[model samples]
Target: MVASLLILAVSGGMLWAVGLNYDGLTGGQAQKVHPASYLCVLLVLWQMLRRGNPVANLVSAAEHRPASCLLAAASIAMAAQIILRGASGTAGAIDTFLQAALVMILLLESDARSLRRLETLVHAVMAANAVLGIVEFATGQRFFPFRLDGATFETDTRSAALQGHPLGNATLTACYVLALIAGGGSLKPLTRLVMIAVQLVALVTFGGRSAIVVTLVLGGAFGLAQLLRAIARGRIPLLAAAGAACALPLVATTVAGLAYGGFFDALLGRFASDGGSANARVAMFDLFSRLPLRDLILGPDPSLVDSLRRITGLEWGIENPIIRVVLYQGALMALLLTTAVTLFLVEVGRRCRAGIAMPMIAFVVLINTFESLGGKTTLLAKFVIVLVALYRPFPETRIARAS
Candidate 1:
């Protein structure tokens, strides 16, 4: 039973990391629900039914009270909203939410040893996915059949990796890379460094300007902090630093050689010119201005929003989750979601190590800036996996409950 549980836990993490895109690979949303989604729902129920299981123990544990409660409430509210509102993308959103929620449950209930193994699985899959992203970028080939509503999802430079969407791939890769830097202790120092480099490049290839910029700001800030510590502790000598600085030309030469294939040219060009994505983000605010007071509270009709989109020339739909929540689900649901997310972070932060929790938290907050949680995205589920992988419970709290 223990062995089976371990396998289940690890497999669930792997499933989310690679996220096979089973539902939409060939064409439209062929299956209403993903196979992975069904497996996750079943896993949660199965674990709950089994006595003395981690799920059972966690429910009765003191430390898990806040997080577990929030998870339950949020899950219930999200499902109710989907059923009651029957919003445009509710079918995909609900499945993604449940899978993410249950994965958190599975992780929260596991023993520390199981978490260690799960962490390793997550790292491996993400690293492999980065490599796959590189291959797709180079070959201009999408491993999964890319079709959206019976039409080919075409792109010139960005890769459709396993995530199937360039922006989603960029966001997930950027966030996962950040999470690894935070708490992915399963990887060795060198392996971690390699992944950091590879996935950062993968971030560029995936072509999400927001993800790249956020990563740089946060990652650069973190790197600066580490550099300061090294200097203060005399771990890095002044002479050695100067020598390294002087070697910048050599480093540039090597980097240029690596970029010889021009894989990075497109992203670099995008940095120079965002093709109105920036304007769109700013212009999206105009949506709320046009909405009536009642529409702001109850959310305007989908057809109405569509007409507004056309008028606003936002043919691509709203990209910001902040605006998405209010415009799609109303302010009430938005408030509830914001409250739940805030509680989940606070509860997990105290339990997790500062290093891991801080980056993971930043990733979540920054990611929603560009990626909407209201859409057909596995982003939430993926974030939950990172949360549970690094979660560090109070041992004594669990012990007291067991006694």
Candidate 2:
């Protein structure tokens, strides 16, 4: 319990740390290590020493061996690229290594002995973020003064919560919501419904178009799955089905009205205007297209942001994780990374009783499509822990005893 709480604190703090600019600690770079990283490092060291045989413990987890090998291979590939490219590539390479290291450390140190404990820790983190988001949205003021910008900190319409960007907040909320849905069977029906409702409200308040769309799709899919399950069991009453069919049109009308209403109009107004966001992504792609074949096979120029700016005359970073990985670390490495993650997700989905893994996977993919969440080391660490927990074999004896 103590270890779980500490892990939760470090993870939750890092999410909130995104919005902060620690001048002395980070030197104004948002990517640099902050207080949370220091705490996490200390916890990892303590846990490693306490265990006495870190290597044996790591090796004992046979299920994680493949993931470990894949991570190592990806690291080597990135390191080789950096060495070939020299000084300019060093920073990016170091960033990637640091992110990977943090994730590995968190996964190794986590004391969650079962999937239930792991889910509880994750849910606690999500709940913290959800509460902060709700407060930020209602009050139009952040609970913490962690701004990416060094100057002029002010909160207005958007609910940034602990994440620096509103879009990031929304994306994180969407991910948590999907996770909850996937693990809903672990909780009572009322508890699950309440948690889902709270998260949905928080996601809507954060107002990211990607979040909104992904949440809607996943929620609809979950509903359909439930309906199908009931039908399969002959549990759904004919009268209930008939009532649902008759009310479908009214529900559709209400949703349409809400979409055109003031709140949703304000929430999604940005996408309706000039296609700036879409165009920027296209511009990034265009810039990548002009790179030399050698660069494409090995890696692009070290100064990816600068190269994009030079080509497109716009100062924007890559938004898509797939494109970002390919541009930074060759296509082969990107494929390896994607395959590793996809396989793990599939494995978890196969093990899940509620069939929530597919929706969670979709949520991750959709969120990454519009945001570079894969680049965030802290969040990535949390994801690694979640994957590890899901991969762990269930304690059959404990389940039988409980039953």
Candidate 3:
């Protein structure tokens, strides 16, 4: 499990690095390295080959956890949309579903201790992403090595860092920080502090208000849940510490945002002017209400895309998730897709209630509302949900102190 995750993270990081300066390259060169997304898929197929029997192979290939299965269904629905529409996006996003399946298999195969190790692997990957984000923001350069550019970080907005999109980068950074919250890993103080600081930088640099909001809300929710759990267990000191760490990001971001020029004011400005981003999102929601039921249920035709272009008077795409899926997949697929995600959360919540893994299902569920789990964000969100549901984190390990 550790090996596979490491491979996936490294491969993703590499691909992301190349993408940062992608503007300079010819289109043909860009296509050359694009196939790297399938590296994790290859690893999963190899594991399937090792399993021997036919039934075992089929079951082995399926998502071992309920949450993963739902996420897998989501991946399929998305891929089907792409196939049906001939839309050009990242193929690796689809491959990420395959990666999720591999992680699920590994979860079913591992014991509790191994599960924690898997968590460690995920945590490491996220930490790496945070570090990469910091580098990108500071130097305006890509982190991963590309076909021609060597290992130097250089600034270029045309090619955001290796992650391709600012939102995707923020998602990777946020997901890891959330994992760090759940596990309460080493350098707890420092990790929490860095996560808070970096999250602010990420949100500001990318202008990804949704990702920032989701991170703040989820971080607060997880922290509160842990605090309550600790208090009930008579671990008051730990609870206090946990509360501080969890609340720090939201607190810091709110203060910083206020100092820089209040976010609330910006939101109001958006609504008032209808030219600010907040109002744009409101407009998208308004447009959704006006879309026909038939289009909403069966997915929008290319005509709707043209209509969006006309109405928005912008010759581009929509950034909102709910509307995007509703427009692309129609109502029926949207309903089933939503049902699958809801069921996964129910299962994860059930596990948390059973005192199995850390209580993070609620946090993930909240985060999913603002960011489409099916889109370009980190695949680890899917892995984290399923791993928590399937294997459960190990019972806390007690290391003996020197006598």
Candidate 4:
């Protein structure tokens, strides 16, 4: 279980380092052989072969009857859709199937019962990425130390860290940071504050506007909850309250000082700019609206990009995961996907009965709007794992009984 946890953490955290894109390979081809998926498969296979008791593992997974059934149904539905529609391309189809397989294996093999172990795994991943980001910031080079020409760190303005893209690094870090905040009282105040500060700095340095927005919103929500809890507990004396109010400006000034010049302005400017990228996404939605109801329900023919290009005379892929799902996989599947995620969030809320999950869920939804997360199986797996860890048996029992 420890080995599995480490595999998930290291692979999911250092995605760019694991998944190398070689020269002469198309994007789809590179995705098909992503090192994270390959390593996961090997790990699963090694466990099965070494134990020689795949049946026992399957039975153990069945203990979580509802989750097991839901996973099985979702996997079948996804596989059937891909097999019937034949995916957008051969490489895409292969990648989808492989990723689907990996997710299934991870869900079945992972033992998330130990919340402490899981938390440690998560912190390890975050710490590794934070160190990598520091290294990349100090030296304008990739941290993986690979010799692949043209495959080195390419982004000049933003910190990619080990997650490949600036947005990917920022989004993933934001999620983990939110999770850490959600695991309230489990960490010391100073330690938690320092961890959040480190991740926030990395997020700001990455300069992903969407990620930045989501992180700030979620972090604010976490802070508000903490304040409310302190008030309810009678921990906030009048003197302390007045002191905090007086120090707010100093805190804000310190944050501003830490941010690079024009950091906040650039974030706002990205939102204000009516660049081709923004126009393309808006045009894609416009094209979606013009399509027939049948296409919306059954998905577009030829491909979303092709259909949009034909209609708007501009080539661009759907950036929103929800929109991409509805466009390519039909509204029904999209509905199912949304329902599953909603149910998971509802369950987390029911178990933990806290405000933490709410902010994290909102962050996930907001980030997915800007970038398609369908292909990011490792990230998704880590997310579900963290959610489960957050509301696992021990914490759930303690919190629920208190409530």
- Higher-scoring candidate on lDDT, 1 or 2: 1
User: lDDT per residue, candidate 1, 1-403, as tens digits?
Assistant: 2322222222211233454323333323435455556666676667666754765555553245456456556656766775686555544455545455555555556777877876766666667667877897788875643454334546345766656666766777777777766645566766777778888877877888778777778777777888899989878977867866976787688678868967678888888987677887888889898888797786677667778888888876587775777777777767776776667656655555556644565557655666456555566666656555645555545645767
TM-score of each: 0.82, 0.73, 0.63, 0.73
Greater-lDDT candidate between 1 and 3: 1
lDDT of 2 at 123: 67
Candidate lDDT values, in order: 0.64, 0.57, 0.51, 0.57
Q: Return the top candidate by TM-score.
A: 1
lDDT of 3 by residue, 155-174 (tens): 22312343544545555555
Q: How accurate is candidate 2 locally (lDDT)?
A: 0.57
Q: Put down candidate 2 lDDT per residue, 1-403, tens digits, no spaces.
A: 3433433344323434555433223444443444444554466566667779877645543344345445545655665765776623333333333343444434533443545687776666667767787787666676543344344245236665555456656665676667667664256755776777778867776777777777788768877899899989989888878877987897688668866665465566666862466776777677566777777766766576466666685443566777777777667767866775555445434433444564466557665756353354334444444444534433434434666
Task: Give residue 91's error in model 2 in angstroms.
Answer: 7.9
Clashes of 2: 3
Candidates 1 and 3: which is better by TM-score?
1
What are the clashing pairs of model 3? Answer: 16-162, 17-144, 140-154, 140-155, 141-154, 296-331, 297-331, 299-330
Clashing pairs in 2: 19-146, 19-147, 20-146
- For candidate 3, which ten residues in a row score worst on lDDT? 394-403
